[model samples]
Target chain A: MSDRLAMEDRRSSRLPFPAELGALVAMALAGLLGYLVFPDDLAFLTRLIGIVFLVLSLDLVTGYCGIATLGQSAIFGVAAYAVGNACLAGLVDPVALLGVGMVAGAVMGLASGVLVAKFQGLPQLVLSIAVGQLVAAMANKLSSVTGGSDGLAGISPGPVLGIFNFDLYGRTGYVFSLVVLVIVFVILLRFVRSPFGLLCRAIKDDSLRARMIGARVYPRLILMYGISGAVAGIGGALTAINTGVVGLDSVSFERSAETLVMLVIGGAGTLWGALIGSVVFQIFEHYVSAANPFHWMTILGLMLIVVVLFAPRGLVPLAVSVVDRIAPRLGGKS
Target chain B: MAWTVLGVVLDAISYGMVLFIISIGLSIMMGLMRVVNLAHGAFAMIGGYLASYALKSLGVSYPLAIILAVIGAILISIPFEFLLYRRIYRKSDELTQILLTIGITFVIIGVANYALGPTSKSIPLPAALSGPFDLGFRMIPAHRLFVIACGLCTALLLWLLIDRTEFGVRMRAAVDNGDMAEALGIRTQLIFTAAFALAIGLAAFGGVVGAELLPIEPFYALRYMVTFLVVVSVGGAGSIAGALSASMLLGLADTTGKYLAPEYGEFFFYLAVILAVFLFPNGLLGRKH
Candidate 1:
């Protein structure tokens, strides 16, 4: 089992044409297909792309680095609120606002990472929850700034590159989100394949062994957290722009928990898992909730339990295994 | 000023007792079985709902309602233990346990909402407990006194049960070394199931008792999950004394913080938690392995 996991990690991290390039192509096609299929629901699609980023960031620390955090929304929400406040403060430029969000997210991530990297297991989980709750409490107490429970609205961003305006139909926002999602995905693909990423996996597999081999474990963990925060920040910024508001929900415990669920539902520790999980969970939720809001949670909960029990590795890996059984030539490529 | 201070302290102690009663089960389970059972709160919710149902629907007496709630919750937990928990108990990884338990919690919350409606359920106090009782200097609600007395009795009984009985010795042996205890002719599996049932029963009792403070809403499971987790972690898992002190400490901090500075809300409570966890990762009374 350990050997197969290690081999799978190697196959994923290697810049193999079949896995990495193919995944990139698949992501692009999926995003475009989403845009075409649901042109009228551009806002929801844009918001989903934002969540995709958040889950990818979560995959970085929790899946790859062996961190058990339930408070990821702390970083994501901080960056989002930063961009919202910036836009309100007359920074209407979309690209520049995203940079603000990224920096804000990184700062919060690094700060949280410093505290979180020192512990393991249950204590670590509690600490993360504390951090997330602290941010949320502060946001609530300082309601004058955050708009309190009503959320900060009236965020108006100028078009992409000062060219395309954010239309009522959300066309510009959807395209903008898609383009940014693709760019981040490509960068993360390379970032994970880099030596730093390999060192992270090594630390995750066995931190004591990595330390014996002269790796600075805590520093690397902190750095990975900062990178993750930046990715989450982009997602936060996109949400701020697309929704034209940032609310307490952005930094909520529920959001953090939901994002983790999405990550696990698709699979964890793999880039494809993060992307597919967010997409599938979000789309499933959209349809299910619309059909029956009352029983949707029960259905979702049942699905989650089944996923955990039957497909502990998540849907993406389960699909891969099934495909491998049917078509050995195609399956063996990865 | 003295009266106000006394009132606040009494409220704090009562509130703290409720928290302790609810979270001790979670603490013991986490410490002993090494399972992060997020659904523990759901058991508490079930207890609260059952007690409320008994009181309002069946017109049962207060003590009988509490008893029924505890038994019902334990009975309900048996299937979950056999089907879901038995499978994951031996796994080395915490992630699978966390995910699977979280799935259980979601299902419980969803089902509770669907069956019982989303409105909050209140367990009304009996006429005897609802009235005010006179202290030498002032009057206070008898319910607060009742809750505090119940908490003290529970703590004492639990202490004796774990510290004095033959079952306690076996439990400690299993906790110390499961394989060794099994080799010594102890049924570790049976001990685990019994312990789990005990934990669930206590959770139900706490829920019924704490309904005044926490309320029995559909979202109760998720809302108070972090609170219960904080108490257990702060108390040091498996350490009854640790759980007691941590609950009292947090309870004091939260109640006093609210009284002294209502504007601050739960800021101080969460801040204190962060500082506490950072300072002592193993918790106050946790035994270092």
Candidate 2:
């Protein structure tokens, strides 16, 4: 790494912790403190964790992998149905449901990857939209299984890991989600830092160059897409278990667009952005909706316009700039 | 069975005709400017609404409404092309284009949803256009025949304009090589403005022609824009013949699905689309520029 990176790393570690570690600690402590102080806030945190996982999944493919997709919500919707279906069948085992979701999601990802990896530009975007609409239609058509527009419910995930009981407040769900988020983040950190990750970024930067350099772009992209699907599936499954409800929102265009916005706001290609971006955007969404349900889209739309026009680099880039400015003032760097 | 099949086939053709109108312009834009306008549907909606107003307020015939709507769309799109699209014409990255279009789509959708209530409305088809025409095999809606006629005439007009006319030649030349066309004193700006206007006029005309089949509602344009643009993708962007072929194919597929099995219908069609795109990644008629 360059000296600037080293100094940034050192700066990240100044508080006797690595950056992600520090962030995780801060979150856990905040969660614990909120549990003690607010108590009711734990459920919200759990939902936030679930939302964060979604943002993370989006970041994995879109931000880090550089694959601009519009159909991830389809995979999320599929996983949700899987989880809810398994639950309705009395298989309330979270682990098994998550695994099933992951497998189904991975399969969809691979299928979509084949379609998308070879295509570029308008065709790809159109295909992605088609994927989302197709899934929505499937879910709508198989109303007998998916419960159609009414959505699936009556899911009582009695306990998580058979140790922590799912209480009235969903404390177990919250903590379980937090643990999963941390574990997934660690895996994703390792994955993105790997050679495959480098190749994906290279493909993103200059696909022609990556191809000329023998990157075997399609297979790598397929792998990345599969992982993204798996992550999205996990997020979906967790959402089903936590809320005890699964609906058409999983495969919605609005959800896909929201996740895209979250990935941008948080900082694409950075793991931390997923977590922070999801939390921040969800809160913003809740507030915007509360202000005016029908017109909130206008606000979110304006934000999207602003970000693309002015802050195309996203929140992470803004953060990096601020840190850069502060470093010299703190006598840390030139 | 034959009656329904014949009816559905006509319905499909009409649907395809509308998609052809909307996408031909989009395909042309993609060919000439290499810019994907996600807001093409908005222009279509504007046409539909304007036509509806003309029919309701002025008591104008459907054909007159369509003409007025097309004119309105042309006038509207020229300004948009000059202000927004002209700036982003040279950016090579699709992602940037995607973002710009998405932003424009959002703003338009918002404004439309705000201004136009969410309730769906339909343009009044005159008795002449609404009549059930007697085909030798079965009866078909007159409006359906009209849309098909409109599509055929537009295709012929476009071909002649591009291949036979000086303006069309200049437009095609500009599409192929913008710099060269500019250097040759082709007055590229006027050509671009005219192309933009013509492209949107087609969308508006389609909007009025096909308004009865698909009702105009808030954000209605944006909802089906992607599906329509798939024609441009399938047929070949900038290739008029390609747009026609793709629209007809997609229209037939959609009609067959809705007719045969409404429940499992859309599912089957999209599955085919996914498969088709996988096999032909650039689209059915895609050619490297």
Summarize candidate 1's per-residue lDDT along A57-127 as a digit string, tens digits: 99999988989898999999999999999999999999999999899999999999998877888888999
Candidate 2 residue lDDT tens string, B1-289: 7777777888888888888988898888888878777778878888998898888988888678888998887777776676677776756456556666666676666666787778886797788877898787767778888889988999999999999998888988898888998998988878877777887888888777878776798777667767776777777778888788888888888888887888774776677677666666666776666
Write candidate 2's Cα lDDT for A112-137 as tens digits: 77776666776687788778889888
Question: What's the CA error at residue A106 for candidate 2, in Å?
Answer: 2.5
TM-score for each prediction?
A: 0.96, 0.91
TM-score of chain A of each: 0.93, 0.90
**Candidate of highest lDDT:** 1
Q: How good is model 1 by TM-score?
A: 0.96
- Model number with the top TM-score: 1
Alpha-carbon deviation at B175 in model 2, angstroms: 2.3
List where candidate 2 sits over 4 angstroms from the true fold: A1-17, A29-45, A326-334, B136-138, B187-190
Task: Please give, for residues B1-289, the per-residue lDDT of candidate 1 as tens digits.
Answer: 9989999999999999999999999987887788888889999999999999999999999999999999999999999999988887645476777778878888888899989999999998999999999987799989999888988888889899899999999999988988999999999899999999999999999999999889998899999988999998888999999999999999999999989887667888888898888888999999754
